[model samples]
Target: MIAPLMKQAGRFSETTVDGEVVLLNLDDGAFFSLTGTAAEIWALIDGARNREAVIAELAARHNADHAAVAADLDPFLADLQARGFLAGA
Candidate 1:
């Protein structure tokens, strides 16, 4: 099944802290601090990419196995979806 789009009403803002980016959810006052691989994956979640494309691109960029990346990404994506930071396109 395709992932659903992030809610339109949710507000997301990002800032760099000590050379790392942190994404914030203004509505609920939640924050996600991204670093290393998680940060890389988070950066790919524009509104234009599908799940498969994201997996492939991230795999190539990180020099990681596709299945492994997908495995790690599934829950992260789910959490972002749950938190309104990412929307499927």
Candidate 2:
């Protein structure tokens, strides 16, 4: 079976400055600021990878544990989705 993907949703504008990402949600006029690992995680959910794949890649890239990364990432992803920032979540 094909896995579910996390894809960007709604209309938005984003900019990166000093390694941090500032995102503006055009639909709702909400703004988000993502720094450090949060910025990295935002960049990874490009509609190409599933939740497990994202977790694995992040864990490997950061030399962190898969379970630990998943524990943190799951809630973050959910929040983004709940806020209409993500589709196919």
Candidate 3:
């Protein structure tokens, strides 16, 4: 089983305007922009969900295969982790 995600490590707040996604960091003023599939995946990382669950949800939502979703998810998750937007499991 996949481990649970840590929500308390950081906080995320997002806003969409004119088809663009702006994700804000609650701890600091730092923010990032996401587009295309990155935006879709970003919306699914609620921090309450595990890596496996996020991939499963994305696969179902986008009608994609699990392996494909997992492959795409790794780098995105790594970016978020590196940016302090997501915590380690």
**C-alpha TM-score for every candidate:** 0.77, 0.86, 0.72
TM accuracy, model 2: 0.86
Give the alpha carbon lDDT tens digit for every residue of 6-86 in model 2.
556556778899998988888888998989888999998877788888898999999999999999998998877776678
lDDT of each: 0.74, 0.83, 0.77
Per-residue lDDT over 1-89 for candidate 3, one digit per residue giving the tens place of the 0 to 100 score: 67665533447777898767997888787889989888777667675688899888889988999999998889878887777776773
Arrange candidates by lDDT, descending: 2, 3, 1
Model 1 spans > 4 angstroms off = 1-10
Candidate 1 structure quality by residue, lDDT tens digits, 1-89: 56533433457888877657798898788887888877766666665566787899989987989999889888988887777776542
Candidate ranking (TM-score, best to worst): 2, 1, 3
Q: Give RMSD to native, each candidate.
A: 3.0, 1.6, 2.7
Q: Which stretches of candidate 2 lie over 4 Å from their true place?
A: none
Q: Which prediction has the highest TM-score against the true structure?
A: 2
Better of 1 and 2 by lDDT: 2
